[model samples]
Target: MHPITTVHYLALSAALLLIGTVGVLTRRNIVIILMSIELILNAVNINLITFSRIWHNMDGQIFAIFVITDAVAEAAVGLGILIALFRNKETVLADEIDLLKW
Candidate 1:
């Protein structure tokens, strides 16, 4: 059996990261931004796992696990912020929020 090439994983991760970035930059909805952030986190995990496989080391895997944990925490915190914003503004649009005004 042939060992997997690292390029495949890197390419996929890049694609996911690009999509997430585009979503973050283009989307007006706060919820979508949070989801885009999650997408970026998942792309980071893919990169870590791929490097781990290429090097035959556990360190990358360990880092991937940490990234996953961080992603979860970030999601929770981001959602909480979105909820608070929605409560105050009555909308989820990024343009609708004015933290400096309040």
Candidate 2:
């Protein structure tokens, strides 16, 4: 078998991005949306690390670590908010949430 290349990594990243975008756009469940957002972030991390490896540079790796850190923070905060919303609304459907409405 042939060795993998940057193009292969890029293709995988693109597929993940497309799936995440579609999930965020089409899903009504808040949890699924959050997962999709995570997927998108992961795709970005893959791209960053892949390029970093190819160029033998540390910048992309450092940036990927930052992205991972941010993603963890985001997931924590998002799940907390989701828990609060579920407690108050008794529903996890995104369309049914109107907590911000005045």
Candidate 3:
């Protein structure tokens, strides 16, 4: 049996990021896209914490904390925007949004 290593953690993070990327690209719903973005951010946090553990340093963890804070703010703003858009447009489809189109 092989022992798990940092490589394993990194691979998992990569997979998560890939899934998130696909979701963001292929999903038409705005809320799902926002969730996918959060997933990508979580993958980043996983990598940061994993590297911090391997390096025996606090920097990665600190960065992860910052990332979490940013994610929270992003979620709040994203949901707020989503609500506003829904109220004005009555739909969540990305293609249906044209408020900024020229």
Candidate 4:
């Protein structure tokens, strides 16, 4: 064993990001897509924090903090949009929300 390291964290993060990307690309449910995006952001934070701990760099933590802020904002705005769409259409499915593609 090469001893668990920051690379392990990075690999996990990459796997999460890949899963999120696939979910976003393949899912028809709007809520699930949004959740996958959140997962991707969370994976990024994990990588940042892991690097910060491994390298003893404060900047990585700062970047992770900023990523958290962005994730929060994305959640707020995305959910707001989802709610508005749901109110208007009564469905949260991405396929049903399309207004321009006939």
RMSD of each: 2.7, 1.5, 1.1, 1.6
Clashing pairs in 3: none
Candidate with more favorable, higher lDDT: 1 or 3: 3
- Model 3 scores a TM of 0.94
- Candidate 4 Cα outliers beyond 4 Å, as residue runs: none
lDDT of 1 by residue, 52-88 (tens): 8878999999999999999899889988988887787
Q: CA lDDT of 29 in candidate 1? A: 91
Model 2: residue 45 alpha-carbon error in angstroms: 0.6
Report the C-alpha lDDT of model 4 over 20-100, residue by residue, as the tens digit: 999999999988999999889989998889988988989989999999999999989999998988898899888876689
Per-residue lDDT for 32 in model 4? Answer: 95
How far does residue 22 in candidate 4 sit from its true spot (Å)? 0.6
Q: How close is candidate 2 to the true structure, as a TM-score?
A: 0.93
lDDT of 3 by residue, 1-102 (tens): 999999999999999999999999999999999999999999999999999999999999999999999999999999999899789889999988876866
| Best model number under TM-score | 3
- To one decimal, what is the Cα RMSD in angstroms of model 1 from the true structure? 2.7
Q: After superposition, how far is residue 56 of candidate 2 from its true place, in Å?
A: 0.7
Error of 4 at 70 (Å): 1.1
In model 3, where do residues sit more than 4 Å from their true spots?
Answer: 99-102
Q: Per-residue lDDT of 1-102 in model 2, one digit per residue for the tens?
A: 999999999999999999999999999999999999999999999999999999999999999999999999999999999999889889999989876786
lDDT of 4: 0.91
Alpha-carbon error at 20 in model 1, in Å? 0.6
List TM-score per model, in order.
0.89, 0.93, 0.94, 0.90
lDDT scores in order: 0.89, 0.95, 0.95, 0.91
